[model samples]
Target chain A: MRKSTIIVLALFAALFLAGISAGEPERVLDQAIRICLSCIGIG
Target chain B: MMERVRRLVQVVFTFLTNGYWAFPFSRNIYQGPLKAICSPGLNCYSCPASTTYCPIGAIQQLMAGLRMSLEMGQLYLGWYVVGSIGVLGGLFGRMVCGWLCPFGMIQELLHRIPGRKFDAIPGLLRYLKFAVLALMVVALPLFAVDEFGAGDPWFCKYLCPAGTLEAGIPMILLQPDLRHTLGWLYVNKIFFLVLFVVWSVFANRPFCRTTCPLGAFYGLFSRVKMVRLSLDEERCTECRACHQVCPMGVRFNENPVDTNCITCLRCQKACPYGAIHLEAGGVRLGARQSRPAQAQSS
Candidate 1:
């Protein structure tokens, strides 16, 4: 169930991020980039 | 069973308000509870997947050494926001953190994980949250800054397990590339999460009991909130069922909604006498039950 919940959360996140990226507010785009970068090995 | 209803209300409300979990919104949207009647718990920052405002973050924003304060007899006057959020929290106690809080739902879910068990934190460690409250929420923000004495969301930055677990983990997981340079912040957050999870196995809700500045903010109001708890001494049989069932360990066999009480309504269900009923916002929800509800010491 925990695994299932994590998977559901992951899907929700991916879908939401895709929607936001599609809409891509110019003001927050740079910030989102920072978030993605932070996700990776980058600082 | 009545427990299912409780779960339903908790899940539905948590989902609607914490859209921040599933959606990305900006902080500029709507001002928090400085506008609406305070819901009973700590929510995340306004910008997260939340459909509503985060009262604690908003209130903290208005505090001295924050952005700027316009004081009216110790009332935060700016945007009339501070008074509004504080009043609401005072009215609700951290019940917002307990019931309506999206983060609270997350923690509750974590605790409910079948294999999970709460580990006890020593009595000495219990004070950690209070130190966090005094230092991160108040002292550091008030006195420490880069020449600006500017507050930098000390709670969100340092103490908020909810933010770290929810917004931080979700975003980081979605953008896996950020995992590369996971720093002390990530480490610290994971540490707290592990500690919180282990602690939940035995320590009740250590985070809610200790480090949540939002919970701290709401607790201030639990005693005096307009929608207060009324105990029928006639109905209470000193069965201690309520105390035994309370996740917060509040001894509410006397009065309900005590300082530690999150108003989870577990006590209301625990009473064998059909004794407990919740009254709030000009409405009542009764969990009519027979027998003393078994307290699951999870």
Candidate 2:
């Protein structure tokens, strides 16, 4: 309800849309689909 | 009722996020369509059954490839993960930590094993998670690139107990070939994993309080999060009942918007008066109505 909270929420929502349009989630997916060797303490 | 519902939600989220049923047969992690979405909680992507990616792990991976991503003319390198986290954080803040985090549920369950319990951890240690989010999650992955122009997921490799428990142990147990690769790194990770597991039995959410980078990241939005706790100072009796029930050591009467608060609302349940309320997007969810004192947890 406050101005600052509304601003912060709107800002993040915009960033989310931009990120999606830029195909950034696909970039994240490329790494995530594989078994992260370092995450499992290997490689 | 709130506590019981929280536990059920935690269980459901844990199952839904890690519901890939082919792991036992394939002896490998799920590489499915759901991997693209980053879950708000701290479930390891490398876990054989995990359907969604862990947000911290995804961000670190993106940051680690900053050099390569830029070289490939990728203008938006880490915005997806950052924005996703921001959206979730701005909505509920550390409510993800309290309700959806499988690791948080594990820690809480461990603490309930009926042993000599400590009220809280050292207050100074509470700041360590912030340092971890800055250093291990952000700074190291962005700046500490290798000769080949790629960095490492430093936190996952060196410090994440969730990864060790959910991914490393299971993968090694299933593959068996991975056992040959086990060395000091695995031993070191296991040490911290065991340390936190035992520590959780004696204290409430020690890892969340002192070391979880994801919790720290969400905590940043506590002040602005749509879903939050509001304290009616005039009606509050200063009885310290809220403090007694807070699993994360947040004293709501003193500071309703404390960064460490998970917005679990146990404090609201504990209060004798209707001084605390849960608000979501300016709408009162609950906690204003008076309840019997017997409903409060000891």
B185-293, model 1: which lDDT tens digit per residue? 6677667767777666555677777677666655666655545445666566677877678777677867575666777778876776656667654345454444344
Query: Per-candidate DockQ versus the true complex?
Result: 0.03, 0.76
Off by over 4 Å in 2: B290-298
DockQ of 1: 0.03
Docking class of 2: medium
In model 2, the Cα lDDT at residue B23 comes to 92
Instruction: Give the per-residue lDDT of model 2 (tens digit) for B1-298.
Output: 9899999999999999999988989999999889998888999999999999998998889889889888988865677788888889989999999999999999999999996898578889999999999999999998999898999999998999999999999999889888899899999989999999999999999999999999999999988999998887767778899988999999889988899999888988887877899888888885357544643332
List of clashing residue pairs for candidate 2: none
